[model samples]
Target: MHELQALGKQLVELPAKQLVDIPLSEKTRDAIVAARSFKHGAIRRQLQYIGSLMPKEDEDAIRIMLYKLQQPHKDEVRAFHQLEQWRDQLLLGDQDLLNELAIKFENFDRQHIRQLIRNAKKEQEQNKPPKSARLLFKYLTEMQGK
Candidate 1:
């Protein structure tokens, strides 16, 4: 299992151009292009929703340094692939791996990450009938105990 703190630190240190790739799955890339082409607010909102799951850390400094590296470019699709490469290089592929690794360093394991990811996805997936922010916040607060 991956150390969440270590992963957080790495994410914080990564350049914005690199971070942009983090959310860029192949499907995400298609959605982004389709969104930009049509100014599709819904797609953009969905992308933003997925992006929201990422820990909002202080990577803004690195992004400022690498600001020019990212733009609405023709190779935006390539960025998606690059992001996938980074995910692989980051070695975040397997839940079991992360859990096993994390246990060596911390008490928490993949089950927690899986739960968090699952809940986040469920939150986004059930967009129409999702829990209110207050309830979500309550759940998140409870998760801290585990």
Candidate 2:
């Protein structure tokens, strides 16, 4: 019951746009919206009321939706890590990875990638800033859109 009340508090705190994505009954949704306008003890009572209504809901589904809303960038973070790995592999002279990238992206410019790799290598040896590495990552991100 305490957990359900806590989840209700989280629901009430969410913006209307995010709340819309959540599966909620009309009565519960109205209570949450009203709770937003409440003050002091009234909001607590409303949260308890919402909690009482939660047993009729699919709790797991609501939890999953809340997780997705709270961590919207989870997938994007994973993809960014993937791009960084690709950039690192290219810098390491992984020719097979390079060939794989070429086969994957139709607009993959082998010459441009090669040039960026060489510049990145030079920067690493000279202890300079990794300008080319950043550009390579940017290029890879653009390729993702195509």
Candidate 3:
């Protein structure tokens, strides 16, 4: 019963697009849609009603699908962090770091990288928008694909 309610609550928290992807019976889907308009006690009751309907569906499969849906977001966050680390290293490290990047990426444009680093440093010193830093990140991402 508690598990059902918990699943119902999770469903309520999902976005409409994702909610559509979950394999739910017509009755359960209608209950979920109706639950969105509910408030306070009524919402709680609707959630309980959804929970009561859970036993007739494949709960495990639904949970696994939700977990799968969330995995790509985690991967994207990991990729973003990796790019940030590389950008920071490029900004702070000496010439050897640039040389290392050049060796790692065959298409690395040394002159352009140096230009961006200089502009980024100037922007930082002036407390301006990090235009060059963003460009450096974009360049790195493009290079990574090649």
Candidate 2: the clashing residue pairs are none
Candidate 1 per-residue lDDT, tens place, 95-128, comes to 5645544554445444544564455456657884
RMSD per prediction, one decimal?
Answer: 19.3, 4.0, 2.6
Using TM-score as the measure, name the better of candidate 1 and candidate 2. Answer: 2
The top-ranked prediction according to TM-score is 3
Instruction: Please tell me which model should have the higher lDDT, number 1 or number 3.
Output: 3
How far residue 134's Cα lies from its native spot in candidate 3, in Å, is 1.3
Task: Evaluate residue 143 in candidate 3 and report its C-alpha lDDT on the 0 to 100 scale.
Answer: 82
Ranking by TM-score: 3, 2, 1
Report the C-alpha lDDT of model 2 over 1-146, residue by residue, as the tens digit.
99999999999999999999999999888988999999989998999999999888889999999998878678889889999999999999999999999999999999999999999999989999999999999999999878
Kindly indicate the candidate among 2 and 3 with the higher lDDT: 2
What would you estimate as the lDDT of candidate 3?
0.90
Q: Write down the TM-score of every candidate.
A: 0.22, 0.68, 0.79
lDDT of each: 0.44, 0.93, 0.90
In candidate 2, how many Å is residue 80 off? Answer: 1.8
